[model samples]
Target: MKLYTWLSAPNPRRALIFVAEKAIDIDIEEASDPDNPGQLSKRYCEKYPHRRVPLLELDDGDWIAEAAAVCKYLEALYPDNPLFGRNAKEAALIEMWDRLAEWEGLMAVSEVFRNTHRLFVGRGLAGYDIQIPQISELAERGKLRLGRFFNKIDERLDQNEYLAGDIFSFADITALCAIDFSLSRKLIIPENCCNVKRWYQAVSERPSAIG
Candidate 1:
């Protein structure tokens, strides 16, 4: 199997972290130029029309696009580390928290970055060539949503060691990536969010995080 990824982006970082934690030995290929955010090579665009990174290509020629899906596939193949979960209940909890992290945390950061960054002036959305105008209102709304997300996660983290539970799972990976990605927009965990700060420090120090 081969992993097509862009290391500079948060989405691919999720997969890379998973790979490091699992110690998977799959071949990796760069799908995008790190300096150029959304510009995909003609060959890459032709092969994967979605034009997204962190894609997993199976030896059989099947491709998995989303970051979560890519991690899921790797987890299935390399189940020893088990980042998803060990049981049905754990799986459900991990899934719920992972979705929340993606929808509430990562998407919020993306909204602000895509709508306000000059680099994305004519391309407000991903995986498309159509010119979508940036909306200042959306960026403002995203900041509000991001603030709420940080508070919610801090509350949750106060009661649990990781996002899903006592164990470190894929949910934590998503949340960590989202939190780090927000830095580009000058968004950060509030000084009073002590729980989140502690959680972030622990996760960021992990060896896999360097991936």
Candidate 2:
């Protein structure tokens, strides 16, 4: 299998971390420059109409897009590590937290970064041909949303070691990527969120967190 990804991007980082945690062996192909969308190759764009990174091409020539979907495909292929969950209830809980991290954390940070950053002026939204103009108001709203997300994360970590529960799962990966991405965009985690800080430190020490 060939995994096409941008090493620095959060979504691709999630898939990369999943592969690292599972010790999966696959060919990795860097697809495009995240800062410059025009660098994406025509061949890759043909294979993935959405023109997004973290695309997986199976040996049999089947293509899979979307970071979470790629992770799910790998999980099904190699179940021993079992990052998703063991049972139905656990799976549901993990899924809930994972979605929260992606929507509340990752998406919020992305809204601020893409809208405000000069490099992404007309490309606020990913995987679309239409280029939306930057909205300062939306960037402010995104920052507010991300701040609340950090507080909520701290509260959850205060009760559980991991986002979903005691065990490390996919939710942790999503959160880690979100936190790191936010930090890169100059959104620092509040000092008052001690639980979140501790959790971040612990997760950062893991081998999978390394690029």
Candidate with best TM-score: 1
TM-score of each: 0.95, 0.95
lDDT value, residue 73 of candidate 2: 92
Candidate 2 residue 88 C-alpha distance from true site, Å = 0.8
Q: After superposition, how far is residue 174 of candidate 2 from its true place, in Å?
A: 0.5
Q: Across residues 1-211, which tens digit of lDDT does each residue of candidate 2 receive?
A: 9999874889999999999999999999988745655456666777788888789999999899988889999999999979999999989999999999999999999999888887788888878767778888888999999999999999999999999998899999999999999999889999899999999999999999975
lDDT of each: 0.89, 0.90
Candidate 2 TM-score to native: 0.95
- lDDT tens readout by residue for model 1, 102-203: 999998998999998887898787788678899999999989999999999999999999999999999999999999999766798999999999999999
| Poorest lDDT segment (10 consecutive residues) of candidate 2 | 33-42
Model 1: how far is 96 from its true place, Å? 0.5
Kindly report which residue pairs in candidate 2 clash with one another: none
